[model samples]
Target: MRPQLLALLARAPAYGYELKQGLEQTFGPAYPQPNIGQIYVTLGRLEKGGLIRGQEVAQDGRPDKKVYEITEEGIQELAEWFAAPTEGPRVRDEFFMKLVLAPGTELADQLTLINNQRRHCLTMMRGLNRLAAEEQGNRVSQLLIEGAVLHLQADLDWLERCQEELT
Candidate 1:
């Protein structure tokens, strides 16, 4: 959220509400919406960190609003974020741990766990498909949904492998 806010600030100066609106407009339903309070908290942190500068602007009839603009340090940070490669999911995931440990304790059958996970992944893929349809015009949303669906498919494939090996 910090980086995203900085990216928006890098574009132009905006108040907290305006930044929230920009995020909603840009990500649509693809990303979780950050609440106004969260935005302000983040803005305060960013200002304290010297990544952004805020100016209080007087309004005609309402309270003054603080508009935020990204600083040079913020731009450099954003650039580094853009250049960095994102890490993949770790091997020691919750499901994998459960698959390994649950059977020894007789808590749950491995086959049952794999089947349940497969069903859940299928259900999620269906929902993502519906969301993709709704956000057909939003390329960013479509891409996000597509990525999620692919990850789910990969999970399903891994479940198949687990069943083959354990069951």
Candidate 2:
């Protein structure tokens, strides 16, 4: 359950807030960012599981911080999790479902949803592009940023096509 959080921490020892921010920044705003409480609780759980260990770091003018590092077992578990091909039922796309159910749904309503999604995606894409460009020496980072932009562009194009078909 907290495997992802644990895996992320395993990559490098990080303070709870630092880990949370890094995940949020990586995944973007569409994904729910785990709160500090959840991070601490999960640290406790992972400590109990023996997958990870944390130490309280004393800081001046700040709350004592728990820094987490993945254990050998944790590294093995994380590697196995990464290597295994994930299997699950296909996730339902609610937008498509809405169109199916409401055959007579107003074009305006569908367009509204598409446009809203597009706006959010565009903003995120621009921000990611800027961040990646600032660190342009990293080919992997550049690829990730451009890949996200391309996917969002495809979605926007599909939305346009859907609008034309509906009209």
Candidate 3:
């Protein structure tokens, strides 16, 4: 959230409400709606950390508003965030742990667990397909949905491998 706000500020100076609106407009339905309170809190933290400087601008008839601009430090941090490669999903995930540990315990069988997970993944893919169709004109939303569908496909494939090897 901090980095996102910094990136937005790097583009132009904006107040808290404007930042919230910008995120929604930019990401569309692909990104979750940010909490306004959370945004203000993050802005305060950034100001204290010297990543941003806020200026109080008096309005004509309303209360004063604070507009925030990115500091040089904020720009550097945003650059680092852009350059860093994100880590892939973990291999030892919840399903894998359950599959490996279930046999020794009183939990359900490994094959049953794999089948259940596969069903869930397919259901999710179906829902994503519907969302993708609805968001066809929105490239960002479409891309995000496509990525989720692909990940679900990979999980289904892995489940197949588990079924063959374990059962």
Candidate 4:
């Protein structure tokens, strides 16, 4: 959230409400929208950290609003973030733990666990595919949905591998 807001501020100075609206417009409904309170809290933290500076502007018949602009340090940080490669998805250890420890616990059947997980993945993939279809006009949302579907497909494949190994 910090980096995202910093990047937005790098574009132009904006009040918290403007930034919130901008994010929703840019990402559409695919991205979770942060409440105004969350935005202000983040802005306060950024101002304290010196990544952004806020100036209170007076308006007739309205409350004064603090507009935020990114500092030089924020620009450098944003540049670094753009240059850095994102880390790959991590495998959840909870599932692995369940698979390995099921025999010791009352959950003695690992096959059932795998089957249930596979079913869940398939159901999720179907929903994501439907969402992707609905978002076909929006490339960003479509891409996000496609990525989710691919990950779920990989999970399903991994479940099959786990079943083979365990059996």
Per-residue error (Å), model 2, residue 148: 1.6
Candidate 3: misplaced stretches above 4 Å?
none
Q: lDDT tens digits, residues 1-167, model 1?
A: 99999999999999999999999888778788989999999999999999999999999999999989999999999999889998878777899998989877877999899999999999999999988889989888888889999999999999999999988
Over the stretch 1-167, how does candidate 2's per-residue lDDT look in tens digits?
47778778877888778878777666554445678899879878888999888899999999888888999888888888889998753448676566445556555366666667678878877887777667566565566667778877876787688777763
C-alpha lDDT values of all predictions: 0.92, 0.74, 0.91, 0.88
Give lDDT tens digits, candidate 4, residues 61-150: 999989999999989888999999998767666887889889868856899999988899999888887776777778777777777788
lDDT of 3 by residue, 21-83 (tens): 998877666677779999999999999999999999999999999999999999999999999
Q: Which candidate do you rate higher for lDDT, 1 or 2?
A: 1
TM-score of each: 0.95, 0.60, 0.89, 0.88
Who wins the lDDT comparison?
A: 1
At residue 65, candidate 1 shows an lDDT of 90
Order of candidate numbers by lDDT, starting with the best? 1, 3, 4, 2
Q: Candidate 2: where is the Cα deviation over 4 Å?
A: 1-5, 8-38, 55-67, 86-91, 105-108, 111-120, 130-141
Task: Kindly give the stretch of ten consecutive residues in candidate 3 with the minimal lDDT sum.
Answer: 25-34
Instruction: State which candidate has the highest TM-score.
Output: 1
Q: List the residue pairs that clash in candidate 2.
A: none
lDDT at residue 98 of model 3 (Cα atoms) = 89
Instruction: Show the lowest summed lDDT stretch of 10 residues, model 1.
Output: 23-32
